[model samples]
Target: MSAPLLLILIAALAFLATHVLYEWLAKRLLIVSGAEYLVLGVLLGPQVTGLFPPSAVAAFEPILVLGIGWMGISAGTSLRLPRLVRIPSVTYRLSLVESLTTFALVAAGATSALAYGFQASYAAVMLPALTLGAIAVASTPAGLDVAFGLSARAGARRAAPVLRQIEVAHGMDAFVSIFAFGILIAAAHTQVPLMMRALTTTEWVVVTLGIGVVGGALFHLFLGSERSPDRLFISLGGAVILTSGAASYLQLSPTLAAFVMGIVLANSLRQPAPVDDVLRSGERPLYYVLLMLAGAAWAPGSNVVWWLVIMHYVVLRTIAKLWGTGIVTWINRAQAEVGLDWGRALMGQGRLTFALALDYSRRGLPYGDLIFTCAAVSVLFTEFFAARFVRSAVDPLLVPLEQLSMTLSATTEAVMESVTETMAQRFPALRKVDPDAKEHEHKGKR
Candidate 1:
């Protein structure tokens, strides 16, 4: 085998191993620090080890982009229309609120970092551009998955129900973030042709929606239930691979395109079993790939970048989230269900930071190294804080089940008595027939 082939094989295995370790560790740690794995990958990457050199890593750039695109699409597929339509008004309102809050926080944080110490004018322009683009758009469904799984394990069904809600919320947020990014990139490009505006504007939206509809229809017609579980799963993966490649070749947004495919497949208003089966098979692998790429993409920088990162990650971003979340709540009246302050506090940054930082570096933006440093750290902190907040929510389903098993025996008995009385009152003849007898029967069944 050629040296290049050997190196590629070694790097691929190393990347996979790092991701597996991170997944294992993320489950065990109280802090849930998965972002560290990505940092580790960078430290061990060719940039440092002279194993897989800069040129070799550069070769993976297209893969990284396609992987990210698939990640977004897969994330979107999870947003079944039923959940989305559950609180259409609420979803729309909260999505706008979450997106704006994230954007404002990232922008302010980026600007403040520049004001204080980011001396390089080139770095300043790129850092805010990259960070703002990232912070505004990120939503970590993986973190939310951890929250839901834990809640299920702890017997908090009520809390677990919130999982679907959060998924829908994150999906909408991702769409908005990506859409906003498309606009931002368009505006930033000086030589953008007038004709390309259509590509960036409503045309993009129409194409995305159209792709989704077609994909969904095809899934509904042929692949819905005819194939075996394994084949059905592989078919979906094949579709994503094709769509991603096509999008990449066309210089179109693969993330948007792939997501539309998922949305289309899942939203066909048909049986959800096929869609569910496909997700069951392919979702985890895709997630692992996306996350590993994310970690591999992190290119650490010098002291200047580290200092700026600290400033933006903690101070500026935090202030922006608090302010933006609060204002959004006030305007949308979402405080009735989700506390204004709490929700604002929980709108922490993550994946989007990595995506945008990679974009900055790939595009050869000046001082892009500093942007990656700041983004990686901010994602680390945000994951920690956001996971904690989500874990703390009162899941009504989870509560009742746990109480029935352990903490609420007495209350359960009292509730049983009250229910008996109400049933007796509502059904006089049945009460006469045997209220006490029925109570004994119920207790015996339990």
Candidate 2:
């Protein structure tokens, strides 16, 4: 009956609706262009909606933070210990190298823009660069999902070395982005002595590893004797969400913690793990809200924002893509039999970029608006090329399957033709080759 109660109910529905809409739209647009959906969020957010008013948005902030934590914890759980130990040097090397490359390129552009008479302040220039750098550290799972799905549709088994390496690179990016943001946030606010102390790169990494170990260990002990069909995933999901939420509250990086959790669970847990279903359940909801929040808050149409967007999103992102892929070419040569031509498969900017931009905005970085604009643009452009590159890279693998299907179809047609011909030649005689006739012939010979 009260206006306050009515508003609360409406906001609840809005949150729920946003998630469902995001998932539905993601499926549809991913087929069209995944990057488009990123902007769609900006369209729905306050700058567009006038729906997510300051008060409404501020109220939702806590929930958004919680969602972020959930995402991080979930991500941490992806880092399997076995996978890490199995390829230690390559994993760490690729991640560090790529993160730095992306950071430098994006930062240089932002710095240049500032020098060229842009309105960005000193903090804005440095902060945006760091934010973009953090984004650069993220890999687009949506792009990967699209690529992998197309590969499967085309009947590919295990992905080629290039694709595999890209996936690993993405994982590394996610790991680095998490901690990088933590350090960035801490550094930006020198007054927060505690934040600075806790977020030293080393401390950030240790905390991440610690969270994973502790979370995974606790989950294992809790679920060791469980026999339910979905025990592995349910238990793991609970731990990830809890760990991520708790870490966020503590001002730690939930993304790193979640990633570490994922890694530990995959290695330490048994086969037929339940993580797939659990992850699926959480992913749709979290991603939907995340994008909407980013979109609703997006500020478009300013010339300064436009200029910044072009510099960072278009030029810098392009450089990063080319450079990142080129690095992959070398890494692939050193470690595997697969060769990746940077010209073909390097369009990978997705949710990770959005997340980093959001992280910076949340921290009051002056370049938040610019970062959002750039990230939204990058997602769009990358999605367009990602589908093409993925299809090209995966096409070769599908050719044999295509050939096999055609061969089988042709053989069947031939067999049917032969059967028809034989029937036409001896329809009546077919009945005459009888059991009694063979017996009679044998008796006569005897």
For every candidate in turn, the CA RMSD to the true structure comes to 6.7, 6.7
Compared with the true structure, what per-residue lDDT tens digits does model 1 show for residues 330-421?
Answer: 77775555545534324555554456455545555555666666666767667765655565543443346557777577878889999999
- Tens-digit lDDT track of model 2 for 334-434: 43333344323445566556666665666566656667677776766665566566556545644555588899999999999888778868886654467
Off by over 4 Å in 2: 1-45, 81-99, 115-124, 150-156, 189-209, 224-238, 327-344, 396-446
Q: How much does candidate 1 score in TM-score? A: 0.71
Clashes of each: 11, 24
For model 2, give the RMSD to the true fold: 6.7
In model 1, what lDDT does residue 142 have? Answer: 55
| Residue 441 lDDT (model 1) | 92
Measured by lDDT, the strongest candidate is 2
Report how far residue 252 has shifted in candidate 2, in Å: 3.1
